[model samples]
Target: MPLKACKMFSNPTSAPKAPSRYCQKTLHLLENFKTLVVMGDEPDREILKMVARTTIRTKLYEALADQLTDIVVNSVLCIRKPEEAIDLFMVEIMHMRHKFDVEGLVLDHGSRHPDMKRRAENCFILTCNVSLEYEKRIFLLKCRAEGGNGCSLKASGR
Candidate 1:
């Protein structure tokens, strides 16, 4: 369940056959997963470094993305910084958005990348924490609540 094993990657038009030992190991790790893999080619080396750093720190993201297929089938992926790396993740989602059932996204705080907001129009943008989780739960409840077209979210016991 390492970041390298998450299989998050980008597909270049003409990638070198024999990549570096590190890239090769990362690629092999990524191929073993079934979730959406997000990556780009321009910053291949940087991304590799990030993955290495993440593996050294913790494998939470990789593990979550790997087993996230069980949560909502489709997902609402939120990448902290998606400026130059936006397209990499976008392309991956575009390819599988139809095959799977990606509902939307909630880009939380700490993302200073400007383009992230503009480019991420494809998904929802959630800026608040409490509101974000509340909205997510409401969305799920709405999905499950049959004939719930005009449901209200006012505070209870008002």
Candidate 2:
């Protein structure tokens, strides 16, 4: 029932010398979970699309076909503002949990915003920074969006 928020490197351009260690670590970390839920920002649309089409989606289907019975993998980019984006992402996560019974949530750029801290307050938090040279940072929030009559869910459902 604990939600984990991890802060890591965001801007990839600064680290020209080496590839993103955060990304590699995050991918490896995701493999340990049974269900995978991914949330990415507008900037990460292409990367998310590649992941959805190639590996994660396929592997999830192969391992937990029954669990994803009604799940829909949406790869559309529509939102313009940061707040709206997070709201939509959370709603999607909730929907996947309630309608499709998803066990994992993978948020790419969705967790980078500072506003997410308020939304993910109840969950566990882990802050990690690779270097200070990077001007921007992104976060990864992982939590089980439990379905029920919870206030947050009720509010978002509306």
Candidate 3:
């Protein structure tokens, strides 16, 4: 008499694709991304509306698309930091918009600087915490060196 034994193994590489009914070629898995979702006072259904059709409801938040997690927001901060304030309370500094990247510099409460038009087609923007006069002095010197008109010949404050 003889006894037979066999072992079976499954392939890890052949794992099931996500959203089986959806696209199998491009699985929008967040395996490599670092994400954080901040729950505001809004109900899940309301928040879900802001989410894009391409994103899974269980996954990333709309503002946090492209790994730009706006962070796990606190309710009061959410009230204070929405894109637009209620008609009663309007303040620029506290109102954060989803249009811009969180890591990018916002520059002076988003107020327009001097020598800039209400609508500019092409322009350069420079920002610093120092006094505008200091920046003006630097700009004046550079402009003079480049033979550009309308700039002071000297650097202020020796």
Could you say which candidate leads in TM-score? Answer: 2
Best by lDDT: 2
Record all residue pairs in model 2 with backbone atoms less than 3 Å apart, i.e. clashing: 3-123, 3-124, 37-104, 37-105, 37-106, 38-106, 39-106, 39-107, 39-108
- Assess each prediction's global lDDT (C-alpha) against the native: 0.42, 0.43, 0.40
lDDT of 3 by residue, 1-158 (tens): 01111112223345443334233222344333534545454435334333432342235454344333223222223445345432324423556555764533244555566776788777776765653321223423535446456555665566
* Candidate 1, pairs of clashing residues: 7-30
Query: How close to the true structure is residue 42 of candidate 2, measured as C-alpha lDDT?
Result: 37
Q: Give per-residue CA lDDT, model 1, range 24-48, as digits (tens).
A: 6766776775445455443343444
User: What's the true lDDT of residue 145 in model 2?
Assistant: 54
Candidate 3 pairs with clashing backbones: 38-72, 38-73
Q: How accurate is candidate 1 locally (lDDT)?
A: 0.42
What CA RMSD would you report for each candidate? 21.9, 21.9, 22.8
